[model samples]
Target: MISLKNITKKYGDKTVFHNFNLDIEENEITVILGESGSGKTTLLNMIARLTDFSGEISGAGQVSMVFQRDRLVPHLTVRENILLINENADVKRMLESVGLSKAENLYPKELSAGMARRVAIIRAFSHPAPLLLMDEPLVNLDLSLKFSLLEKIKELQSTTGKTVIMVSHDVKEAAYFSGRIIVLKSGGEVILDKKRVSEKTLTETLLNGQSI
Candidate 1:
């Protein structure tokens, strides 16, 4: 398990989280659900130690992250970019998993948005990290692609049994991928923490702004 004790994060005078705390279970998929600026991403950053905060975070292993943006290197091919993180990574298998086998030698600029996103995800998952953090990774894609990637994510987690913490505002996504859901209101307070429910129920709760 990963525990955060009295975490306080601020950007100058603007505080994102004030003495907040959370515990993330190992080998489970936890979704941080919230609107923009609700500090969901901030919390993930703190967990990944990508940002500085005043608190104690323990029991987290090395983390691999997929950002909201596809941050693939422009100069390198998909396989090369993935190899940059893990030389022992099975580039061919990862590419095939995402249906990008033909694009292995393609650079970031050569791939479409969805393909680039797949490459970014493959790169993150290929890295040998016990904890994986994703920040609204399905934001801009169409519904079909979104669900495809969602299934792929679930498959990866089931196969690897890695701890996954994903932050997203989509209720359907939270319901689909989360074993546990932490719903945050503004300023990083978790208004609801509950086990997963049916997609219809989850959608209603989110639509009505009701906390479980």
Candidate 2:
């Protein structure tokens, strides 16, 4: 389990999270949903220790992240990117699992936007980490592709049971997880938290900006 206590973050004089507290269970998918400046990405950053904050977050050991942007090495091929994290990784099998086998030898420059995103995802999952953090993992993809990638994520998580925390603006994406869904308002406030919810209710809560 991951425990966050008294999380207080600030940028200049504007506060983001003031005395915020939350606990995330192990081996589960928890998606953080919120609007802009609602501290969605900031919360992930805090957990990954990419930013500074006054708080105690325990049980997040050796975290791997898929950033909002696909931060791949331009010079490396798809297989090389995954192998960079773990030399013993089954690069071939992983690529095949994600329908990226044909692009294994291709460099980031040669890959389409979707292929590069898949490579970035494979690289993160290949890393030997207990916690996986994804920021906007499914952006700019078609509906079908988005759900397919979500299934891939589910498959990986089931096999490895890594604690996955994702930040997303898509309610349909949240509905697909069938796990913990958290809706945050401004100041890192949690307006709704549920394990299972229909898209209609989730949309309404997000639109109303309050718990129903």
Candidate 3:
């Protein structure tokens, strides 16, 4: 399990989290939902130790992150990028899993957005991290492609048994996972937490601004 105790984060005078605490189960997909300034990304960064905050975070060892953007190297091919993370990474096998076998030697510029995103996913999973943090990784995709990537992520999580923490704004996307779901308000307050909640109920709860 991951334990976050009294997490206090601030940017200048604006406090994002004040004595906040949350425990996340290990080897499970946990989707965090919130508005723009609800500290969703901040939380992930804290867990990844990418940002500074006054907190005690444990069990987040060797985290790999997929940011809002793909953040791939423009000069590198899809195969090279994944290999950069793990020298022994099965480049062809990983690409084949995501139907990118033909694009192995293709640079980021030559690949479509979805393909680049898939490569990023493969890179993160190929890393030997037990904790995976994804920040809005599914944004700005068509419904079909978005769901397709979601299924791929689910498969990776199941196969790898990594503790996955994903930040998402879409209710449908959060509901897509069978693991735990956490909803946060602007000040980092958890308004709702559940497992395998229906999409309709989640939408209604978000709209009503009520805790469940």
Candidate 4:
């Protein structure tokens, strides 16, 4: 489990998190919900040790992240992209799980936005880590593709059960995918944190969606 206690960060005088605390259990998908500039990404970065912060985050293991940007080399094929991250024996299986089997030889230039995003997802998952962090994993995709990617992500999580944390603006997506949801305000304060209801409960909320 990842335990964050009294976590706080500041850039000069501006504060990010103030006395924030959370206990992310093992093998659970924690989704963060908030508007733009709510420091959700900052929080994820902190957890990944990619950003400087003044706090105590207690966890000892490898961590990998699927960045907000696809971050793929435009000239590299899908297989090459995942290989670039880690040249382990698990690379082929990872790509297959994310549904990029047929596009194995296609370069980033040839894939659509959703397809590119899936490549990034497999890249992160390819890393040998106990914790996985993803930011807006399904950023620019049509609705049909988005849900398909979501299911693939779910399958990947189930296979390894690596502690997963993803940040997204869509509450419906969070509610549908995550086992627990943590809502954050623009001020970096956590507004709500609750376990997501089952699919039947989520269907009721998603179908009657209002403005986020």
Model 1, residue pairs in steric clash: none
- Off-target runs (Cα >4 Å) in candidate 4 are 197-212
Compared with the true structure, the alpha-carbon lDDT of candidate 1 equals 0.89
Which order, best to worst by lDDT? 3, 2, 1, 4
Top lDDT: which candidate number?
A: 3
The TM-score, computed over Cα atoms with residue i paired to residue i, of candidate 3 is 0.98
Lowest-sum lDDT 10-residue window in model 4: 203-212
Task: State the weakest 10-residue window (summed lDDT) of model 3.
Answer: 201-210
Q: Each model's C-alpha lDDT?
A: 0.89, 0.91, 0.92, 0.80
RMSD to native, candidate 4: 3.9
- Tens digit per residue, CA lDDT, model 3, 58-167: 88878998999999999988888888889999999999999998999999999998888889988999999999999999899889999999999999999999999999
Ranked by lDDT, the better of candidates 2 and 3 is 3
Tens digit of lDDT per residue, candidate 4, span 69-95? Answer: 989987887888788778774656666
Once fitted onto the true fold, the runs of candidate 3 whose alpha carbons sit more than 4 angstroms away are: none
- The lDDT, on a scale of 0 to 1, for candidate 2 is 0.91
Using TM-score as the yardstick, the better of models 2 and 4 is: 2
- Model 1 alpha-carbon miss at residue 169, Å: 0.7
